[model samples]
Structures are given as C-alpha cells and as structure tokens.
Target: MTSIFYLHGGPGMSVAVERTRYPQAQEVHWWQQPPATSCAPHPYLDLLEAALVEFRRSVKERGAPMTVMASSFGAHLATHLAQHAPESVERVVLLAPTYNPEQSALRLARRALALHAGHADADKVTAALAAYDAAPGRARFWEVFGALQLLPDVPALYFGPQAGDAPRHFVEVLQQPGGFDGVSAVAISDDFAATFRTPGRSAFNGPVSVLFGRHDPMIDAEHDGPIWRAIFPQASLRMVDSGHFPLLETSLEACLA
Candidate 1:
C-alpha cells in the first residue's frame, strides 16, 4: 500500500479534527509550530525543514514515494516539498491551498469588504487592507492580515453556501494558544518565500487533485483555481459544497472522492 502523509494548515492551526480525517496517514507534528502562545518567530523554513525530515523518513519506511494530502498552509508546504524533493512525492491532494499569503489575504479582504459593506465593520476591513498595502515588509503584512480574524464579520467569510455553522472542534482549535499567531509568525519570516527555489511547472508532473469550497471566499476558487491548475499541470480541480474546512463541513468520502 502507498504511504499517505497528511499536512494540516495554520502554520500552527490544530489538526485535532483534521487528523481524524486521515487517521492512517503519516503526519508532521511541527514542534516549531507549536500550539502554545509565544513571541518567538515560527519561521516557515523551520517547519519546512522538519517536515522534510519526516517526509523522507516516511518514504524510507515505505520504500517508495508517498501520497501527500494537505490543506491551507499545509498545502502550500506540500507544493514546496514537491519542488524541493519531488522524488519522494508520488501524488498530491491540495485542499484550498494558499499559494501566496499576500494575494490570499487581499482576496479575503476584498470579499469581506463587500460582505460588510453596509455593516459597521466595513471601515475596519478597508482600514486593515490599507494597512496591509502600506506595510513595509512581509512581517507587517502578516500582522495586518492576521488581525482580520478578530473582526466580527471576518469569521463568516470562511463558511460555505450553507448556514455559517462552524464545527465545534474547529472553533476550539482556532481559540488554541498560538493557533492564529503562528500563522503570522511563519509568514513574517524573511525567508518565507525568498529562500525557496521556484522550480518550473514541469518539475513535478505527478497526479494532483485540488479541492475548493464553492462558497469559500477566503481563498476563492474562482481566483486560485486557474493558478493551481497551471502550477500542477495534471491537477484536477473540484468544487465541493462545503467551506474552507471541507472535511469538517462535508463528508470525508465526498472530499476524497
């Protein structure tokens, strides 16, 4: 049987619920991206290095390439891994992968701006986006973008077409220490994007499946679908009926199918 590896999002988002979906898959529980709160930087390189080590070990144990299933930032990491060590990855399943943090944030901000147009928080969204634009460095960008989670209207943007009823397990994970902050910390790292090599699209021609939620505005499928398709030439895009957390909102069978 092919080894399966699961990578969760949030630079530090809890995988308690996500892990359940891939119970048998190998997971990289990043020590650098811990759940506890801290001021220290959780650089992307740190997590990437650790994950690479874990991935290599999994490959060695199975004596073959492994299938990678990742979500959000985890999906981003998986893509990077495919580029960095494509030989170890046989296939990839990306769930709402965030290719560019700045672009993703901008998309979400624009959506939030529209959603809260008449609401009291409309100005807040605009101001946040403005702050992000004026920010001098990646660190400031993450700082500004991360603060969006605090807005009363921002949470609703992640849900799908159904009522915005988030899973209880997911809600608790976000509330965890460092859960949200780790995201900014990792993205703020100077080497977040610059350190990685940008390989050509032909680098990894493995089978790829990209899943997106129909109502997911945070990483809108409409904007990113084409990008992912171009990046992974063999990628097959699917628009599911759930939100950002597809496994939590929709059945795993449907998502995997």
Candidate 2:
C-alpha cells in the first residue's frame, strides 16, 4: 500500500481535518513537530525536516510509493520537499497555496513583520484587535501583524460558519509559548517570494499539480495560474468554485481526482 501524508496549513494548525477527510488511505501520516508559537528561525524547514523523517519511516514500513496532500503554507513545504526529494514523492496536491507573497493582502503581513522587528508591544496589538473584534461599528482591522497575533479570529473573517472551531484551535496553537518567533516569520516572508520567483534548480523530476480556488484572496489566479503553468509545463492547473480554502469546499475531491 502507498503511504499518503497530509500536511496542514498555517504554522499553528494540526492535521485533524486531513485525517478526517482522507481516513481510508493506508498509512496516513500527519506532520506535527514544533508548535507554531515556538521561536524557531525557520518553522517551515523544521516541520519539513520532521515530515521528511516521518516520510522516510513510512516509506520503509509501507515499502511503496508516497503521495503528499498539502494545503496553504504546508503546500510551500510540500513543493520544496517534492523538488528536493522526488524519489520519495510520486504525486503532490497543493490546495490554496500562497505561492506568491507579494500579493496585496500579504502586505499587511509583511508590515506586521516590520512592526515585530521594531519592538512593537505584542500585548497592545492583541488588545486592540480584541477590541475591534468586539465592536460592531469599528472597521475590520485586517492587518497582517494583527492577524498573526490574533489568528483565532481569521476563520471568522474567511470561513464564516466554519471559522469558530478552526480559529479557536489555531489560536490555542498560536498562543503556545515560543510560537510565531521572529526568525520563522522572516524565513516565511523570504521563502514565499523565492518559491515562486526562482524555485532554485533541483532534480525533483516528478509530476506536479497546482490547485487554487476561484475566489482565493491570497493568490491572484489570473496572474499566478499562468506563471505556475509556465514553470511546470507538464503540471496540471485547476480552479475550484470556492474561496482560499478550497479543500474545505467541494473542490478538494477534484484535487484528489
């Protein structure tokens, strides 16, 4: 039986949805390493290394090909792994990948990084956001730094009906000690640009697939879709009728298909 690994999005989220969604697969593995709140330099790299180690172990146990289903931030790590270790990964499914960080929405996140580096008070920022959340007449404070600090409220903004549970779980993880460290934030910002602009030459000779939602706010489908198609000429391009979290909608089945 082939080994299938599911990598969840965000630096803080767990693999609960991946497990529940793809329960029938044999030897399903979820990548869970250092919590997102940890102050690691490169959380993605850390998680990627951990996931690779687990991938190796699973490969040995199952003694077959491997497939990866990665979403959001996890997709970035999965693509990196696929490019560097093609021998282990046969197919890759990327759901709502933020391949390009230069998007307008990401500007707020970049600003948040600047704020953190400039010694901004974390408590003050969090309190202000909490106040905004409580107020009905206030404008939505959707700044990236604020979002990073208060990730628990992100689901409410994006997922609406599905936001409450996932956002709470995300907040719990984000609030953990050492979570959202400076180094990791910087690395994510840099890597996001590098992934799409110059995906460094690697011997990752394998089939690649990119899936995005039609209404994805993080990525500009009109611009990014063509870029990805051009980069991976043999790759498949898919647009689903949903928002950024296509996996949370019906398009995921098409992705797996």
lDDT minimum window of 10 residues, candidate 1: 28-37
Clashing residue pairs, backbone N/CA/C < 3 A, model 2: 37-178, 37-179, 37-180, 38-178, 38-179
Point out the worst 10-residue segment of candidate 2 by lDDT. 136-145
User: Could you give me the TM-score of model 2 versus the true structure?
Assistant: 0.64
Q: Would you list the clashing residue pairs of candidate 1? A: none
How many times do residue backbones clash in model 1? 0
lDDT of 1 by residue, 65-129 (tens): 98877877687678777878888888888887877765776677777667667766567657767
CA RMSD of all predictions? 3.9, 8.5
Off by over 4 Å in 2: 20-27, 36-41, 101-143, 147-154, 157-197
Candidate 2, 89-136: lDDT as tens digits = 877777777665434344333344344644445455555445555762
